[model samples]
Target: MFDPFKDFDQAGYLRNLYGEKDPQIVRGLEHTLFRTGLDEALAHVAKRRTLGYSDFLAVHRILFSAFYPSAGQDRAATVPNIAVSKGNTVFAHPLDARRAVEEGLRIGQDKAALRQHPGEVMGWFAYGHPFLDGNGRTMLIIHSELCHRAGFCIEWQRTRKTEYLAALNAEIASPGQGLLDGYLLSFVGAACERQLWGGAIDGIRGLDGRSIEDAVDGEYTDVRVMQKYQAFEMSRAMSKADRR
Candidate 1:
C-alpha cells in the first residue's frame, strides 16, 4: 500500500523542475507516460531481451526526442557514428563506447535479481554518456524502465541536485554501483508507495510491459501528461544536480 499524495507531491516536484505552464497537468501526464514506458521496458527485460548497442542507442534517442523535442538532435542516427574514447575522457573512442553499452546491459541484467538500483544503472549510462545531449534524461528514463521491469519503482523524493551529481561523479571515478544503490533504494521505495496509494494506483497495476493500451484507459487518462512532465522535471533536476 503506497501513499498517493506523496506520488502527487513527487509529480509536483518534477513539474516545478520542468517549469511547466500548468505544473500539475504537466506532472500528471509525464508521470503517466513514464510509468507506461517503464512497464513496456520491464516486460522486455522479463522476456530476457538482450539489447544491443544499437538498441540502447535507439531507446535513448526515443527518450530524449520525446522529452526534449526542442533539442533537434538525432541521437539514434549519431550513436553508431559516434565512437567511444579511452583514458577517462568523455566520448573518447568507439571501442570504449561500444564496451560501455555492452557493460551497461550486462550490469543491468546481473542486478535484476536485487532491488532495482536506478542510480547504478544511471551511473553506468552517465559514465557511458552515449549521446552528446540529453544523456542525463536518457539515463533517468532507461533506469526507470529497468526498475519497472524488475518489479520496483524509482522513488525520487527530496532528491537534491548536489547529491545526485555527487553520486554520479563518484561512480564515474570508481566504477562502483554502491552510491547508486543507496539512492535508488531510498528514492524508489518512497515513489512506489506513493504511486500505490495515489489515484494512479490502478494505473500502475494495469501497466503492461507489452503495450500502452492498458495505460491509456480512462483510469490513466491523466497519466500520459503526467509522465511527460515527470520526465521533463526529472531531467531538469538531474541536470541541475550534475552541475552543482
Candidate 2:
C-alpha cells in the first residue's frame, strides 16, 4: 500500500495495517459508495438557489468524505504542485485557486453563458484543482447542473474518453479555446434530469489528469477486510457530520 503514484498524498487506502498496496481493491471498495454520495450531493445542490464555488467544495466533500479525511478542503494551504496524469499539463498554483474559481463562477453563473461557453467555465474549474482528490467528479456534477439549466446536457456516454481527454488537455493548455466545446457540441443532447440518476454516475467519467477507464474496470482482488474497514469509515464520517 506504499505505492507512491496511486497514493501520492499517502492517504493510506489499505484495509490492512500491513499496507497491502492494491489500487483496485481500494477503488472497488469506494466506487459503489461514492456513487451513493454523489446522488446525495446532486439532490442537495438542486435545492439551492444558484450554484457557486462553494458547491464545488461541498460536492467534493460529500463524495469523498467517506474515504478521505481532507476531502473538500482546498489545496491553498499546502500549495502543492500538481502534475497531470494524462499529460504534462501544469495546473494553476494553490494561491490562485480561489480567485480563479470565483471569476469562473461569476461569468458562468448565468445559465446562458455557461451553455454558450461551457469549456471556458470548465477550464477555470480544472485549472483550480481545488481538492487534492475527486477534482473531476466534483466538477462534473456541478457542470451537469449548469448545462441542464442552460437547456442542454452533454451526452457523456457517447463521447470517447481518449477524444474528450485530448480536447480537455488542449483546453487546459489554452484555457479558453473551443477545442473541448467543439468536441462536446456534437454529443449535445436534450437535458437530462438529475432526479433519474440511476446509472448516470456509474460511468468512467471521473477523469482529471488521470486514467478513467482503468480505474473503473479494476481487477478486484480479494480484500476480505475491506468491508469492515468501510463500515468503520462510514461511522467516522457520520460522527464528523454529527459534530458539524
Candidate 3:
C-alpha cells in the first residue's frame, strides 16, 4: 500500500531524458509544456466548442501531450482503482466515475445550467476525477467554454485558489449542497473575447495538478462500469442554438 501522494515523482517527469534531479529544471520543463500547449487549446475554444466526452479527453491530451503519456485518457481506462486527494480532501470512488461524468455533461449543456446549479455540476465532474493529472486546468477551459456558451464567464484571475478549492472540496464531499455555486457566483464576470483568450488562459496556474492518486487496482473496470458510459455524449441534446 504505497501512497503516491506521499511518494514523490510517481510518474517521472516525461522530458527528464537524462534523469535530471534538479527541482528547478523539472519545474521549468513542466511550465514550458503548459505555455506552448495553451496556444493550441485556446484556438479550439474560439470555434464554439460544445464538448462531448471525447472532446473532454482531447482537451487534456492537447494541453499535456508534451508532459505525460496518460494526458488525455481517463484513469479508468488505464488504472483500475485510484485514490485522489488535494492536501486533505479526497475525491469520489473510481467505480462511479463514468456515471458521474455522464451526469455532469448532461446538466452543463443548458444556457444557465452552471449558473443555476454550479455546485452539483462542478461536483460531478470533479468527482468523476477523469484525468490522472491536469484535471483542474483542463476542466477550467471546458467550464469556461460552457460559461461562454451560456453567455457568461468566470473571472478566473479574480478567483483566489484558497477560496475556490475550499468550496470545491465542500461540494465534492457533499454533493447536493450549493457550496461551490455560492463561492463561484460572486466572481462571475464578463467573458474573455477571442483576442483575450490567449492572455487569459495561457499560464502555469493551469498546470498546478490539483488531482492526486493513491492505490491502483486492475480489477475496477467491468462490464457494468463500461456500460454506464457507452451512450455518453458531450451533452444530453444541446444544439448550436442552445449554446448561444
What RMSD does each model have against the real structure? 15.4, 13.6, 7.8
TM-score of every candidate relative to the true structure: 0.48, 0.73, 0.73
Model 1: number of backbone collisions: 35
Judge candidate 1 against the unseen true structure and give its global Cα lDDT, from 0 to 1.
0.46
- The CA lDDT at 67 in model 3 is 58
For 38-122, candidate 3 gives per-residue lDDT tens digits of 7677667657446677767887888776656667777667454544445444544555666777777788787767778755677
Error of 2 at 242 (Å): 51
Predicted candidate 1, C-alpha RMSD? 15.4
Over 25-108, each residue of candidate 1 has an lDDT whose tens digit, in order, gives 543554454544544433443354655565555554343344433232332333333323223223312234556656666676
Error of 1 at 231 (Å): 35
lDDT of 2 at 159: 75
The positional error of residue 151 in candidate 3, measured at the CA in angstroms, is 0.5
Candidate 3 residue spans exceeding 4 A from truth? 1-27, 45-49, 203-244
Q: What is the Cα-based lDDT of residue 125 in candidate 2? A: 79
Question: Candidate 3 local accuracy as lDDT?
Answer: 0.62
